[model samples]
Target: MESLKNNFATKTAILVDGGFYRRRAQAVFGDQTAEERAAELANYCMRHLNFHGESSNLYRIFYYDCAPSSKRVYHPFLKKQVDLGKSDLFEWTTLFFNELKKKRKFALRLGKLAEEQAHYTLRPQIVKKLCNGSIQFSDLQEDDFCLQIDQKGVDMKIGLDIASMAYKHQVDQIVLISGDSDFVSAAKLAQREGIDFVLDPLGAPIKPDLFEHIDGLRTCNKAYTAHTQK
Candidate 1:
């Protein structure tokens, strides 16, 4: 069954929120790029959704987020080091965003996981810190806490794409990456239209009620997603 599902999957898409990434940063990824982030997410979706399905036609990842991807360009994060009240990270971000615009690989961190990952992604330094008492559980606790804030504009995109795909008959199944309760309505509509709607946890703990309308969801492929940036 697993092999068949993996083989048959097709026409997948990933929808994201620009403001969500920015807020997740909450001052860490000081400067963010939508295109770069979108591209990365698209890659993630493509891999998981089996863009190259049984027919070898991998699903098209439709990135939906606010345009211009530039909401953190001049955000204030400097505490008087080299410049007084000037956002050095944001300044550096201009170059990062430019690079992302060109290559679309400089997407900033999403939030806490993003922050620590920026400095340390399965790195030896982190391992050394753990060995030398430089990093501890407190660091883990503080970084793991998220002060949930409203991410507007994402709902509309999710709604539009799910409906569009169903109306256009784009795929045999639709998988969503979010657990936010807001998408219940959209998921229901897709199921009503006879689309095989599936929700993927991506290894994140799911909130039970998400995708109430969808059915037959497979737990994330642990071996594959164990390395996802949380």
Candidate 2:
């Protein structure tokens, strides 16, 4: 316990999912103390991690969210308008049967997160193909379309920042504050190239696969220290 507690003070950068993270934070501390909690989460990482090495620049935490647009913001309500009384709208998810036909984990996470909030499903429409029945997956386009945000553009920017740092060898090691498995590929790439990777997911301990693969995995708990930031 003593050694574990001490590991938090280190050179670390946190990768956070803006929607899930903030919502989780809010769930933990309520709306009034949200910013305080965010700031405290940063401080908590610094205090606990033993980041005493060559990399002077620690990322602290990189928060990610999609870029926000009014269209994206209103996408849910508009989708609800379209899905009225429709049973095959893929049940609880905003994803149409056509949409889920072409799957991406990122899309699934975002769509499920959206449905969790009950804002109506925001799955994109596919152009039903005439040739032997296939759906053209515009949402799965690699060019970052569904990335338009309601929480706004936090996640994409966070991802780009991580990529930039990894490309530039920015930090000695990174301590991601998220558990969104979307980052697993990036983490693996970092480790394959000999960069140290770590995780400090806020509400729980480091994930088991991450623990096995990452060089360092620190556990973060809102309860250990007061969620109230000084």
Candidate 3:
């Protein structure tokens, strides 16, 4: 085990929902390399030690995400049929996962993506124009169609690990970095097992049901770029 620098008496495990963090980080940090993001992730989790002026030993970090889909689809922006397998987004995601794999005490849990054809919603602007007689439905282009890709198994893996860790006594505290309320049951189970359950929503407003289940609501208050400011 790495030396426990914090003086707290608990062992803490940080579980991260990779998809949520990526979206939030992109909104806040603009754009960053995968290595930089992974480093920020570790640093963010470690900052939990400052809560209540107490410190805890870092047990591990569990990151859950789905790999990018390789399916071919109509590109709305490019206005053509495209292969996502050859897309820049796919390349970047691959690099991101590779960088995450190199972080110490970090475990990556991958899930599957299911792509299906569904009725696509027109952009709000187009819809408003049509409704107000400014445009017709015939104005909609085929490029406006989209295929939805749903993530599978990511949440299940997180919950399963929570149960496993609680039952096995792997850690005394669990810090989950997710906004999904689907974890309420799992959080309850962990809390019932005498684990200090902390939720780090990264400053996102959480549902009341989720807030009631956690022992603490903490967030990484600094922007991602703040790390470089000093």
Say which candidate scores most in TM-score: 3
- What is the per-residue lDDT of model 2 for residues 51-84, given as tens digits with 9 covering 90 to 100? 3332334554444443222221223323322332
RMSD after Cα superposition, model 1: 10.4
lDDT of 1 by residue, 117-190 (tens): 12212345545777789878445532333222233455676787789888888776676655456777877888
Candidate 3 has what TM-score?
Answer: 0.82
Worst 10 residues of 3 by lDDT: 221-230
Q: List model 3 lDDT by residue over 1-230, tens digit each.
A: 33564443678899999989998878766688767877777787878755556677789989999998777776655566678889677888898898888888889999988656522356676667888998776677754544456788999999999999999999999999989999999999999999989888777778999988988887766542222110
Q: Which candidate is the best by lDDT?
A: 3
Best-to-worst order by lDDT is 3, 1, 2
Q: Locate the minimum summed-lDDT window of 10 residues in model 1.
A: 111-120
Runs off by more than 4 Å, candidate 1: 1-9, 17-42, 51-56, 67-150, 218-230
- Between candidates 2 and 3, which one is better according to TM-score? 3
Model 2: runs farther than 4 Å from truth?
Answer: 1-11, 33-35, 48-60, 67-160, 205-208, 222-230
TM-score of 1: 0.50
